[model samples]
Target: MRLRVALLTVLLCAATVNAQTWTEDGDAAALLPGQTTVGSGPLTAINGTLTSGTDADLYAIYIDDPQNFSARTCGGTSIDSCLYLFDENGFGVSMSEDGCGAQSWLTSQFVAAPGLYYLTMTAWDFDPLNAGGLEIWNDAPWGVERAPDGPGAPGPLAGWGGSAGGSGGYVIALTGATYAEYGPPPPTGACCFEDGQCQVRTATGCNSLGGNYLGDDTTCTPNPCPPPLAGACCFSTGGCLELTQPMCNANGGAYQGANVPCWPSPCVEQPPGGGWSDNFDSYPQGTVLYNVGGWTGWDDNPDAAGVVDGSNYRSAPHSIAVKGAGDAIHPFTGIQGGKWVIKAWQYIPSNLSATTYFIVNSYYQHGGPYFWTVELHFNPALGVVFDSLRDPNATSALPIVYDEWVEIRVEVDFDAGWLGTVWQYYGGQLLYTGNWIQGAVGQLAIGNIDLFAPHPETVFYDDLSLQPWEPPTPPGAARPLFAGVLYGGLPTRTTDLSGFPNTNWLSGFPFEVDGAAARPDGAVFISNGGFSGKLYLAPVEGPAIWLCNLQYPAEGLAYGRGRLFGFCNFASPLGIYEINPSNGSMTLAMSTGDRRFFALDYNPVDGLLYGYTEYGSPTGLYAINIDTMQMTFIAPPIPTANSAARAMACGYNKVYLVPVYGNEGYDMYVYDLAQGVGGVWVPMTHPFPESQSTGGAAFAPGHVPGDTNCDGAVTFDDIDPFVLALGGQAAFNAELPDCYWRNADCNLDGSVTFDDIDPFVALLGQ
Candidate 1:
């Protein structure tokens, strides 16, 4: 019996040894395939083991075609696995989890070209890509040693809450790639020089030439070199442009050091239009607020000082709170003329039963003699809010919503003085519009704001700002034609529609946009199609604003009637919903029974909402009467086997549709409504890049050359508007508020000036 047992044990040991084609070294160094060479013209099965919970097995492979390569861990015993692929530069190329049940694989398109790469197979919770605050391969250049997030201190990657099981055998199946043989580096590899140039050179040659050597077998088809840094270039006319240092010097503009942006326009010596903004995020919580961070106590009294509170905040973490005898004061400078807007986000707790005042003073001295230009009171006990500056004693009809964040805005036309209007708004709704001063008030300059908290009920304030205000331009105004495309990784590209096929890519977004609508004011409203249902307003000249959520994926968006509307294909009573531009609140405008619209746009010329559908009943180009949810079919369905509909837009008496599939070149179809033929959709030439996933499309209004008066003609009546445009954009906007200034650019040189007189005259002759 003892001899039989000994024989069985020996047999089991031999079988275990035979199965392990590769074994762990129990260190950071990677392992190589034990059975087969990679890229041997066929798939190879490599066996490895995770000896410990922190154990990770990294295999070096050389791929001839990265696109065809596939790696997956199948039938691993007792192992919850994670897989990662990195290029020769150690940058992440692909990652996968759960490709095989409880194991990992790379099934998606790889993000690298043919090259030497690393394939890492780690235990469930181990992620080398997320090294704890260390300079890993993700952040460093080639040849730099990166800190590994592994079986040591600082532990495995954080935030991944997957399986914790570890220490088991793993089987890796690899194809379209080969095991890398170690030796001296390759004779020729891609090298990058300081001037952002790339060339193939030997390791020794690259070192002597002061170039960065990528690795053996590396190629430069995609150009691995980084581009040169760009900085602000200042012109004599106080115009700032961003360009590389060499380009700036060539253009004869003074460079403003490296990496400096042109935003906030550093060329201006003073605050542009004189404004101030403070979110109070920089101040420490519970700190005394006397003479700190441009904030002082009322009447310079230390006992009556406010404190930075963390208990309640709108913007997050911290906000200024005031109670009895805790008054906060913030002063302003260089704010005198024009229409100045003061805004603050206020939060009042539901438990409050006392009154508090938000005061704005025109003439304020430290000790005495304060002229309160505006005084707004919040009284949750009385269930009402009112403005003391209203000449006829204006009060709010709506009750104060406690425990909610509300925007308090006061628009003061200091230029109008006593006759100037004081417009107050709460929660984006106009509360009152009255005299700026009650009776013959003298001073016009805005001096300071006093947070008067005489009662014990605490009131919090955050995200304060004082800046010049401009009224919103009405819809359908002439401006640069722009379009927005949603891409992966939360970056949306805003492209100029006028430069289609060679479009100018403007800004990036922070979230994945599912639908977009371009405004004539050079702004775009974007929505997320995900279940989160978020919408955002991104202006060309200002910061993006979170408007509101629609509670459903908005498949398309359009701007018309001075309001934003979203099309929802999959919602209860699915159809279009009218969205308020100011607050993002929405209401169902109409319902489309049994019809699904994939994309939507509004034609200003016809005053109809244009809708498009790729498949299903009523599939074609149609016009929707938003008031009644009725659709008018315009054109029959077109071929869509090679592509799918992405977005739709209407302008220039035409309807445009963008179709895409698998990153192929961008193809568009346009239907001229003026034809009324309902013929096949005509293809238009455009230059959209290949492989980018498109989500939405929109059209910004463009000006007609020589139509300065915006009367839709090049007649003699446009002469005066053209002359006013020559004075400057501000002057033209003031006199011809409804006219597009760029219409005066008859020469199409991007400006209105004396040089355009000849072209203007030619248009007059025509």
Candidate 2:
């Protein structure tokens, strides 16, 4: 038994032996660049075991051009390795040690005009009895050597030629170009323009983009020195014409910045906008179908057949073409849960069948158990099939022109509909929308899927990308402020709604409210931020009660005509909900696409809800139907630098904008609420100190009784208009408007806003 145990130990030890074990006296043979290579550099480490403190090994290589070079004992080994580089003449030209510190790597890339070079690897492993090996690269690709979260005490160093502090399997790459054209972006202020269609950009860089002669180090600050805003945006089909942001945003082409014409830039992600873009233009004329795994085929194999067609294309010098039915998939990151728009330009030379499919969010991997796959197929009879969710006999024809290049798109929203949804678009118009029936989970895979396998048709594709379809980041100073109507309490220090001479009518203490609204019964309702999911109701006569769970803590809440309305501005698409007054339950009223409403209030006069939408170029006010929830773009008249107002309260005829104090970094803008004047947010005086933070607002107008003006008699004369003007939102002209408030200042107060609502009702009762 003991002899068997000894033999077993010997077998285990012998198993670890192989090409991995480097011998000191082994052949000083040459090694190929990538044969033993790891991710970054050529492999030089022959899994060697250390003999003693004096043990070492050497390897040789011949180089024709001067290039960046480095060597290290990598692979998270505890080899306090020392490395040396010698010229052909045997002179030790350079040397490195645990220069990477705890990373225990020795690296140097300044090797030049190489003829013959020898690298010696040695380490100071305390456990010398254990097998030791030298793992290294000759020309290491630039990468973060050490990160705050990793071994070598460090920071981020990207690209090539940077040293790393972490121990890991590293490979080497060689570059002889004295100048680096693409590195980190040229300083933030420096303007950069790429893609035949670019946003307006100023011309200033180290050198012109398409030049090989280095030495162009000019800086272009597109802002301060604005780029030529006017320019022809070029499309992949090689179409070009001048257009601006608004035009570029809509036109199916690339919007290259100012001064840059379509002659050289690449066109990509036409019409649709995304954080990242590709036009296949970067591929040399003979490139092929490949994954990000560097030119691998659509099937993810480097040798997979495909072509970068320069002869027939859109946008630039190249587009991808598959001889037969082939697929290509792209991935995305940093996008939130909402709609992801997948777009691509495809040229199908021959006719095809409804069997020709395009897929979105398809994750049927390893061959079976299908996840959700939104497929678009061309069936001459059925038109475009919305894949899995197609209704029986429902033929929705997607018009596709053959032998021509056409753009196709699909919008996948994982956050809405009964089981998520897919909306297909053709020629900038929504073609069809289909809901997912099965597949509850999967990944975002956008590309081709052949439902009718082995179709002899070839499909050329280009400008494919997934863009985020969500709200613009809220305006710089826009914040949800709290405001509510008070029918039965004393104004407290915290719930002060006084814009000027404060009032005694107050809300039962505010609870750090971020949003507030009032029911028709005069009970004030409030919610803390959008994700809190909790709301409160302050009765007219008693304490505030923890109302039912809102489920969606909407940033904007309103009460009108016996119902509760709310706008939830969280991660997913902005959703509108109707809250039940009794139990605080919620029903998804609708989705406003990406339009984010900052605050809203129901207009008692028209029974319409008016509020601010901060999703477009400039923030604007919008009117929403109380019943249908259909929103009409009233006007984007507010010119605040970046959508500024966070909360607004409706008065008689005007809306009051409130600031969250410290949140805004710029001057507050005030808009004219009077009718006829288009909305323009002009800079206004900030009434509160910068430190004060207010969440929302409710207009409380008081009144003076018996005077003709607030004289108790409501009339259409200038006196009545002037008196009611104090009520706000009141449209007072020669013609009597419903908004004109009667300064029934029943309590003999000066103003006539909501504060007089109860008092006016009392007078009416008399």
**All predictions: root-mean-square deviation over Cα?**
27.1, 24.5
For each candidate, give its TM-score against the true structure: 0.34, 0.28
- Model 2 misplaced regions, further than 4 Å: 1-510, 520-522, 539-543, 571-573, 637-642, 661-673, 682-688, 691-694, 700-766
Model 1 CA deviation exceeding 4 Å by range: 1-481, 490-511, 540-543, 685-688, 702-766
Please tell me which predicted candidate would have the highest TM-score against the true structure. 1
Using alpha carbons, what is the TM-score of model 1? 0.34
| Model 2 lDDT tens row, 50-87 | 34444444444433334444555544356555454455
In terms of lDDT, model 2 sits at: 0.45
lDDT of 1 by residue, 176-200 (tens): 5544542323367898875466888
